[model samples]
Target: MSWQTWRTALISAAATALVVGLLTDTGQPTHPTTVAQASPPASGPGTNHAIDDPLTSERTRAWREDRFGMFIHFGVYSHLEGEYTRPDGTVCRDAEWIKRQCRIPQAEYERFAAEFNPAEFDAEAIARTAKEAGQRYIVITSKHHDGYALWPTKVNRWNLRDHSSFDKNRDILAELKAATERHGIKLGFYYSIWDWNDPDAVHPSTFGRYKERMYAQLKELVDNYQPSVFWFDGEWSTDRPSNPWLTQDGEALEAYVRTLDPKIVVNNRVGKRRLVDGDTGTPEQTIPAEPVSGQLWESCMTLNGSWGYAKWDNRWKSPADLTRNLISIAGRGGNYLLNVGPDARGRIPAESVDRLRAMGSWLVRNRQADAVHGAGTPGIVAEPDWGSVSRKGDTLYASVYRWPGAGGSLTLKALSGFDVRSARVLGSTQRVAVSRSGDTVTLTPSGAPTNDIATVIAIGVAPPAPAAIGTGTGLKAEFWANRKPGGTPTVTRTDPLVNYNWKYQGSPDPTILYSGFSGRWTGFVQPRFSERYTLTTLTSNTVRLWVDDKLVVDNWQDHGPLLSSVAVDLQAGKRHKIRLDFRKESNEAVAKLLWSSPNTPEQVIPTTQLYPA
Candidate 1:
């Protein structure tokens, strides 16, 4: 469960995928809302839903709309309360991985199952907590890495039913499922792929048998509970150097799960959770600073530092801090899955409940819960220093974490071009005075902020002008068609953008040489707003870029799919010279130039903004 160790597993898995070439991601719709049946699970030699399937898109979109979810890490490890005294007069304190971290023997670890009785576990209360927290979904540990199952499993006797002191017929998972359904929230299960106590999973000879048992257990969970999400973990090779799990295993398991229920959402950890691995990317314990383009993602972080219950780990995040995180993640087009570890008696820490309730109360009081639901990155405005921005349709919701002085002006510098209709403070009828200057609009609330945590400002606007290609639009592109950059170009023409993917083919011009080509694009780019812009390039082989005659990206050596970015100040109504040079060293050629400013979404420089140089 250490991030460093998980990264090692990811690297190994990525290498395997590259060797096998089993994943190729065709583009998917950025947002789709219709529910359609998934294609029959993929057959030989590729990932499930590698192609754009309507069902996958719909399911992914729906999951993304949930926006926030609860993650419960409860298992037999909670009984230890993060401390284990060894026979050799040594004591170790840890959560979840007590057996491994404390170096307890398998027999000794098994004995703890007898004492794993969560007598106070109230499924209704847990589900209610999620609902009260404004969380739309819940993913609890069905089985942890310790190989302790929360529910009764027929596949093994090491489960709560057969081994634990808890009542044999009491099914926590089933109770949770019913409670979640009653509360109108989705339910999911987290299952660890690694098993410390299962001896069959260690040796090479018995690994396949262990895998079969794992599959059977998964099937049992699916048939009994019908979960909406199957979150997998512990696939990385940490303790076991001879770990037999492979990308191929992940692919097969994913396909099998789809066959059982294609509607289920699976995390990327089912494989490496890298490119084209699973339905969604899982970034643990951290929120990405920028929006993760081309992939649906979620960040899972604990309330404190530990995943399982630790009596001494009382480092709970404040409700205000958690609320801001949720807003920040939503602004960056991702979901927040917050964790809560229940103690030995099946009681959620009072601190966690109090904070969660406070957040739910804030959401309702601000009337911005719907604004966070399915809200995406603000494409029309730059994020402000005082707050974060999320967009739903043409409306922008600004969650101001730092309030300006009471009745002070909240300036949106880049919103001059937008035809803003109205502005107001959410959850209040306080008149907001809107005034405009040359390229900026200011909103001054009549009263102080309604809440101390984050004040929501709602700005309604007319749909902005389309960023259409302008009258004279094109870049002067010169192609060598053969060899690296040198001498006169073999072909020259006006191209719209420095965008091409000659990975499987060669040469944009049929007259040019098919392989080992070089090209340069020169143009003038005009910005729509005066703001700081992030210029980005995704390229293969050697590539470099210059903006306003100043070098920006300089990857002048051979490479594969290298993404480089640089930020620069730009002015509206002014044309800046831009140039990009690339050479196809050998295979997998690609080049793209993209930019995003405060008021613009990241996109290839459009034809309207480019002129032949």
Candidate 2:
């Protein structure tokens, strides 16, 4: 019924995994188990060590502790409806709105430099408002998919300096950087790896020769701005198949970036297979069951439906929803990057600001519990229930979603190891009765409370070393082809071009799938292990498994992406036959399937089997 009820029930079900190290003797508090040691990466600058480095961990901690940050998406595409236009008058629909709105040719789009004056832009005011809203960082889009550079660059003339009317001399980035620094707020820059204007970046024709100019401009941004974080996006370019950005050369690009600023944090989108530095962006509404140990992750979400300001988009999240999401992310050891789309004039919409302000007020009232370094308690469990709990160290804050008309006693299980010092409603300090028996703790209100929403119950525990927090673990599976024993198998995608017109076919959902336009291709697998196994496909498209049965993956909901996987146990030492059935749905472009295992390199699915599949 209520969100609190649903959250509690979901968390309770997921808590089974957590119950392993928690059960112990009744009188003494149980100490959490030691987390497993992390292995080193197969290849990279920080090889053979934990992937989560000090800088990354520190950043993650700061982010989690900070609890809130601002995201700004402003670029040439903000003005242009589609992505970009070609030299010819014919517009590329792939560019989305940028291509649709900017009917002008390259020459005319270039002249937009003069008309790009954002007279109402106020960097100081924006920074101040963010501070008042209790935000700790400001991430701005320095360059988006449209390839229009916001700051002046020596690598190319397609920048605000040469084209904009803002004194043609003043740099928006420089001003924003200075203002943010003055306000004691960290600044981050969003740089898109896919640039339509750069010949070397991604294009169908010029296969080799990635523009050195692009790297030069990247160096300029790092050297000049010295951003704390380099948020990258748009890696899914149209030219991926032939010029796969994840090649050795692409890895070199990321290494080059780190060389420029070793302290700078980079997101997964920087590399072809998301190998740069951190976790892929998780949407806001989703929460992982286990903490991803030894990895830096942040959930980037919009306050409303869109990341950028859309005049017609009015959907907004409520204050309770925002605060609850923030708590949920923190509980799972992740940061929340809340987005705010400024208008064409570069001012944050007033409505968005008001909502953030409301959230800030709530945070101020509960600063101690929600502070960055606060300990995370196991989530409150509910069974078709009515409330939730927030725990920090010895105290548990129980929030009753609704006051049961009959006023029954509140039951909290799995809390018997600690002593219940007292219970009190948050707004008032009045103590309530708390009783513990075995694994359950019960709390009863002294009288009917005045609150409309939930009430709090604080349970104190005997001080001990806080449970050692675990990062996360990984799951691996192996598959073999045609009962082959020790034979090399080729793994190739049915659609190798990523033409943006292909569809996936398989059973069981794949952990990873490739989707893009232009670079339509399939992955060919060579098995590393020789064993008999089952193959499952996880997709919504019509796919025929050529290996055994002309098994169909899915034939319905052909337009949207779906996940399916095939799993068959195999014996070591064998060669086998493995083939995928793939076809394209109308207007659907691009498809990819990956076969992976513990022996395979992380994030990479081997195309050719080393052994028989």
C-alpha RMSD values across all candidates:
10.0, 18.0
Clashes of 1: 3
Off by over 4 Å in 2: 1-56, 80-97, 100-113, 203-211, 237-243, 247-250, 272-281, 284-294, 366-416, 445-459, 463-613
Model 2 has an lDDT value of: 0.49
**Model 1: per-residue Cα lDDT over 157-261, one tens digit each:** 667776677887799999999999999999999998877656666666866767777777788789999999999987776444235676656766776787788
| Cand. 1 TM to true fold | 0.73
| Cα TM-score per model | 0.73, 0.60
The Cα error of candidate 1 at residue 471, in Å, is: 22
Q: Which candidate leads the pack in TM-score?
A: 1
What pairs collide in candidate 1?
382-598, 469-608, 470-608
TM-score of 2: 0.60
Q: Give the per-residue Cα lDDT of candidate 1 at 437.
A: 79
